[model samples]
Target chain A: MDSIMRVTVYIKIKPEVLDPQGTAIARALSDLGFAGINKVRQGKIIEIDLDKTNAIKAVSDTESMCERLLANTIIEDYSISIGE
Target chain B: MDSIMRVTVYIKIKPEVLDPQGTAIARALSDLGFAGINKVRQGKIIEIDLDKTNAIKAVSDTESMCERLLANTIIEDYSISIGE
Candidate 1:
């Protein structure tokens, strides 16, 4: 039986990129009377369950997934974490 | 002058809720020839910069924001963290 591992990948837009969703969120907060909000940036978190035992291989595989599909490397940066 | 604080809010679908995005991600990973993937769940992260000195007030304000707009509490759950 393969050991199960949980992986978390966080993908965020590059600082130089403009995030419209973040802008909308900030405006909404202001409209709601929540003041003192300077800025807002939105990103995503993808959690995956993998049938693998080796921690090193799990991280490498997840990173590849992020590079290929999970994240748009051109405009976003992604980090991965693996857990038992 | 109000001090600056950074807040991160993570929103995820409730376990009982059907996650089509997650399903799509899983299928995509499989199509990419990466096997042994059991499940995938997708979520969002919103990073906010606040001009506030009091950490407690900042958290409360952020929580209110989450309840009002940041998250759809009926089908999603959200967690928040504040940092300097």
Candidate 2:
């Protein structure tokens, strides 16, 4: 038997940093014919693997991780969703 | 007038590598009472700013940036989203 879980974390800028990457993406989309896609912002999605059963515990733990190490709380905000 | 755009890039694990960070998050969630949250994965979110109106171009440029510099496409995957 295998006891494991998977979760995804989303973290992004707090609307402060300059988004040059986003601008570049938006440009690419236009070249690709993705109309109406005026602006482009990029965020991070982290997938984690763990050995556990309690899902709630996972989210809270991840959130704290985001606050402490994963993300810069002063300039970035993060959200977590767990599953599998 | 600001001829600029914002894009968010989400970079995450490729589901093959073991995520120690995710495991730690799961453990933390259990302590916080976030029931059902079994796993937790952490990722990165990058916000970029650009000077342009053509959104399509922005996306393409950003994608290339991810492929070239912004993200490591080997053990990780990335997605882009656009907005004001």
Which has the greatest lDDT? Answer: 1
Evaluate model 1 with DockQ and give the value: 0.93
lDDT by residue for model 2 (A23-80), tens = 7766765676555455456666666665675778767766776776667787777777
lDDT of 1 by residue, A1-84 (tens): 647789999999999999999999999999999999999999999999998668898899999999999999999999898872
Task: Please report the candidate that would top TM-score against the real structure.
Answer: 1
Clashes of each: 0, 62
Estimate how well candidate 2 is docked, as a DockQ score: 0.24
Candidate of highest DockQ: 1
Least accurate 10 contiguous residues by lDDT in model 1 chain B: B1-10
Model 1 per-residue lDDT tens digits across residues B1-84: 546799999999998999999999999999999989999999999999999658888889989999999999999999999872
Candidate 2 residue-wise lDDT, B1-84, digit = tens: 766677667777777866687678667756665555555566677666656556788788778777876677887788888863
